[model samples]
Target: MNRRRLTRWLTVLLMSTSNLLALPALAADEAANALITRLSTEVLGSIKASASVRTGDVTTIIALVDATVMPHMNFKRMTASAVGPAWRQATPEQQKRLQDEFKTLLVRTYAGAVAQVADLSVVVMPLRASPQDKEVVVRTEIKGRGDPVQLDYRLERTSGDGAGWKIYNLNVMGVWLVETYRSQFAQEVNTKGIDGLIATLADRNKVNASKG
Candidate 1:
C-alpha cells in the first residue's frame, strides 16, 4: 500500500475508535438531561395548574404520578428488598398486597409533595461521572422561594427503546427519600409483619389523601 493510503486508513481507524468511546458518555449526558427536563416540566406544570382553583386536583396529580412516575419506579424490587428477610416469609397474598398498597401510598405521597412546586426551579448541574452503561445520576439544585434544595435523579437509560432514561430515585435536600422509606419499611416489617406494615401504609395514605 502507498504511504499516504496507509496513513489515511490508520487515521480513519483512530477516529472511529474515538467516536465509539465518546458515544456512550455523550448519550448518557443527553439522556440524563432529557429525563430531568421532562419530569421537572410535567411535575411543575401539574402542580401550578392544580394547586388551586380545582377540587379534583389531587386525583389528577395522583393519576399523573402513577402514569409518569410509577413506571419509572422499581417498586416490586424496591419493596421486596426493602422488606428484607421478612419478605421471604410472607404469603403470596401478603406479598401482593404489600407491593400493591406500598405502590399506591408512594404515588399519593409523591403527588401530595408536588404542592411544594410553587415558585421552585431546578438547576441541572454537571454530572460528576457516568457510572454505568445503563444508568446515570443527574445532579440538580432545587431552589424554592424559601430555600435552595439539593436534588439528584438517578436515571436508567433505555435510549428510545421505550421512554428512555427513567428515574428510579430522587434525592431531595440531601435525603434519599426512597432509601429512607426502604429502611423505615424494613423496620416496620421486622416489628409488625407485612400485613401490619400494609395496614400502616393504608392509614398513612388515607391521612395524606385527606390532606391533599
Candidate 2:
C-alpha cells in the first residue's frame, strides 16, 4: 500500500477505536470486542483470501465493508445530524435520498480504509466520570510497535431505556471527524442548496459505485 492509503487506514481504525469508547464501559467494550472478533475471523480472513486470488479487488472490499462495517455504523443518523438545518428544510424524499447516498459514501470510504487494520491492540480505558445522566467522553489507546495513539469517543444516550450509547463523534490524535464532516457539509449547503448537496452526495455515491 502507498503511504497515503496506509495513513487513511490508520485514521479509520483510530476513529473506530475512538467511537467504540463512548459506551458504559464493559457493555460497550464487550459489544465492540465481539464485533471485532467476527470481523477479524470471518470477514478479514475472507478478504485476505480474496486478495490473494485477486489483489485489490474493489468488489470484495466493498462486499466485506457492507457485511461487516456498514451494519455496525449508524450512518443515517450521522448524515442527518451532519447536515444540520438543511435536514429540517428538506422534504421527506429528499431527506431519505440524502441519507441513503451519504451512508453509501461513508461506507465506501471506511471500507477502503479497512486495509489499514494491523496487528495493533485497542485498550479501552476507564471513564473518569459517570455517563448515566448525560453524554460522556470515553477515552482509549490504540497501541502498536510504534508510538501509541489516543482516541476519544463522544457518545450520547438514545431515546429508549438508555440501553445503548450512540456514537455521534470521534477524536483521533485530537482531530474530530464528525465535526470536520459537519463543517464540510455546512460549506456545501451554503454554496449549494439542499438539493444541490443531495446531488453532490449522489454524485459521490455514483463515483464509489463506479470504483467498485
Candidate 3:
C-alpha cells in the first residue's frame, strides 16, 4: 500500500481498538442504568395500579414483590452476606430456612413502607462507575412529602445461561440494607448461633405478618 494509505489504515485501526475497549464499559453503564430505571418504574406502576397495594396490604405487596421485585434481586447472596460467617457452617437445610425467613422479613418490612410511598416518583441519580466495574451502585431519590428518601441499589453483572445484571443489596438514606442486617445477624449468630438468627427472623416475620 502507499505511505499515506498505510498511515490512514493504522489510524483507523487504532480508533477501532479504542472503541472496542470502551464497548464493555459503555454497555455495562447503559444496561445497568436502564435496568434500575425500568425496575423502579415497574414497581411504582404496580403499586399505583393496585389500591390494595397502596393500602399497605402485605399479601398484595407480596404478590407484587414476587411478580416484579424478586426476579431482579439476588436475595440468596444478600442473605448469605447478612448471615456472615455463620452461613458457612449452616447446613443446606438451615440455609434454605434462613433464606425463607429473611425473604419474608424483607418483603413484609419494605412491602408496607413502599406501598405507602407508591405515589412518589423515583429520580435516578447519575451512576458513578467505570467501564471495568462488574458491580455498581445505582442511586435514586424517592420524591414525595418531606425530604426525598434516598434509595440505592448495588448490582452485579453476572454471566452464564442467564447472564445479566442482578441486584444484590440496597441502601436507604445512606444505610446499606445487607450491612444493616449483617450487624443484627452477627449479634444473633454470636449469642444464639445460626438457628437463633433464623428464629429471630422468623419471629420478626411472624409479628410483621400479624400486624399486616
Best by lDDT: 3
Q: Evaluate model 1: give its lDDT.
A: 0.56
lDDT of 3 at 87: 94
Error of 1 at 169 (Å): 1.5
Give the Cα error of residue 160 in candidate 1, in Å.
Answer: 9.5
- Residue lDDT tens for model 2, 16-132: 332233334443434433433333234334434444212434465445544544334555667777888788898999888887777566656655655445455666665655535
Taking every candidate in turn, the Cα RMSD to the unseen true structure, in Å, is: 16.2, 5.4, 16.1
> What residue pairs are clashing in model 2?
none
What TM-score do all the candidates reach, one by one?
Answer: 0.69, 0.69, 0.79
| lDDT tens digits, residue span 1-212, model 3 | 33332222222111111111223343334567676676566656655666875666667656655564444457789889999888999999999999989877766765555445455677888789886789998888767676766667788987753456767876766777688778989999999988888888889988988887
**Over 4 Å off, model 3:** 1-30
lDDT of each: 0.56, 0.58, 0.66
Candidate 1 structure quality by residue, lDDT tens digits, 1-212: 33333222222111111111223344445556654654555445544565441233457645554554445454566677667677889999988888888766655544433443455666777666654667777787766555555666666666542444545565655655457677888888778877889899888888977887
Query: Alpha-carbon error at 155 in model 2, in Å?
Result: 2.2
